[model samples]
Target: MAFLALQKDGTQRAWAAEHLWPDCTPYRAAGNLRSALCHARRACATPVVETIGQSLRLAPTVRVDLHDAYRAGDEVTAGLSPPPGTENGLIEALRQDLLPEWPEDWLVIEREQWDQLRLHVLETLAQQLQATHRFVPALQVALAAVGIDPVRETAHRIVMEVHIAEGNVASAYKCYQNYKDMLERELSISPSQRMRELVEELMPR
Candidate 1:
């Protein structure tokens, strides 16, 4: 499945048999490649995978979550607000790690790319919620972003802003202090000056 996914795309969907099995020396001698392709064709009863001129192509009916998530994230980043009542589910889907169990280098790279993309999406969603004065959901999205990448200062800052907007000065201060402690303990560094200023602005002094 992974191999086929790696090969498929909108413009170029087919992969030559030679490309799929570069070393046909042994397999061809034993007729293993032919037998395997035959079984694969049979297994794809719905015809999602079809042979075209000695190459395999995935049908348009096939859809991948990774692709869908990316497209949605792009749309969100491009200022397309998600429909009401679907924010939580969309956020949850974006939070999922891509192919966590896969140890392949390609999978690792793609996973990291998706992770960053989702973080951006989360941050954007939080900002949109904050703009609309939806502090509760904004806070939730900010916290989820922080949970995914604890060292991301933008998420921490959004969380602080949401708490402050909700009139929870104490909670905002506590969140800042916790972030400060975590940064110091983990990276031996303090929060950014801008972040410190934000907390100071909320102080009673």
Candidate 2:
């Protein structure tokens, strides 16, 4: 819940005991809440979670890397790539899934949201690279998107587009065919007409 609050606003948030301890109302008496807050403060080497007037929040000094990465990914998606020397690191950061080991319901929703955000960042970067005629990196980014979610047709489409733009018509056809087969096998459905037309446009005369 602390994580969720920080993610929502990147600041300390005040939540009533009822909000934080929804399942344990009987145990949320003033003395018990004070003891719990003290224990929380002691559990960490430095002060982290803090209580203020019957509400709880992380200390002002704490900063979370996950939030930073999320903002960076958003910036990249909005056409603000990192400086030249840092592009590789930024791309690697964008590739990571948030809290992959956590099984909590909120974390599950956040994971899916972050995954889609990362996919969008990759697709945007790939398109930017393609516009600059940097075909190799463009293809790599598109391929990474497909690896993250094979069922995402836009990623596969981007891969095929990169291949065709690079004069690899045969590779483009093969990519489309492979995606077509996967869709048919996994979902019992055919690729969309737009995807089929893209391949057709790249077909050798």
Candidate 3:
């Protein structure tokens, strides 16, 4: 239910009413929200919901996986290598999205959040891989991220930049084109000037 709510791109209220209580009438929906929270709390050891008047949110105490992954991504972006023992912890954090098997229509805001975080994790992982001269593996992670969220231009940009830095002009240009085509197809948008210039530099006349 939390994943359903978080997957949507809006406030929590809509998820409570829509996915959580698809059969609920407007008059009884608020009560249903409370019931759902109660049930979720019973099944989990932690507080799942925090009540604040008419709005109910995931409890402040929850340390969500995606949030942890974002932090790990940031650390990687800052060029911090994970210690040998900690690699599993960082990779484990990004290996899955919560409630993958559940399908719920809830919000547009959350989908964007997931996309942004996915892009961050992928780009960070790619950077780390490239730093160690693992070009093929870096591309795999970066490209997989782009596949997961085609509209996220940054994933492709990260791969392209890494390729350029590695002196693989061909790979950089290919990644840039892939990004450009994806953006145009998914969002009807063009690549940013920075992306365009890098790709152009790689292309031979």
Give the alpha carbon lDDT tens digit for every residue of 1-205 in model 2: 3453445443222333443344555455444556766777778898877555544666667876666667878888888875688667767877776767765544566778878988998998898889889999999888888888989999999998898888898999999999889998999999899999998787568
lDDT head-to-head 1 vs 3, winner: 1
Supply every candidate's count of residue pairs whose N, Cα or C atoms clash at under 3 angstroms.
Answer: 0, 0, 8
Could you tell me every candidate's TM-score relative to the true structure? 0.80, 0.80, 0.62
Which regions of candidate 1 fall more than 4 Å away from where they truly are?
A: 6-39, 50-57
Q: Please report the candidate that would top lDDT against the real structure.
A: 1
- Model 3 residue 119 CA deviation (Å) reads 1.1
What local lDDT score does residue 5 receive in model 3, on the 0 to 100 scale? Answer: 36
Question: Against the unseen true structure, what C-alpha lDDT does each candidate score?
Answer: 0.78, 0.75, 0.68
**lDDT for residue 85 in candidate 3, whole number 0-100:** 74
Structural RMSD, model 3: 5.1
Query: Mind giving the per-residue lDDT tens digits that candidate 3 earns over 36-151?
Result: 67788799887766666656666666656666666667777677876677665776555556555656554355556665666676677787888788887787777777777767
Order the candidate numbers by lDDT, best to worst: 1, 2, 3
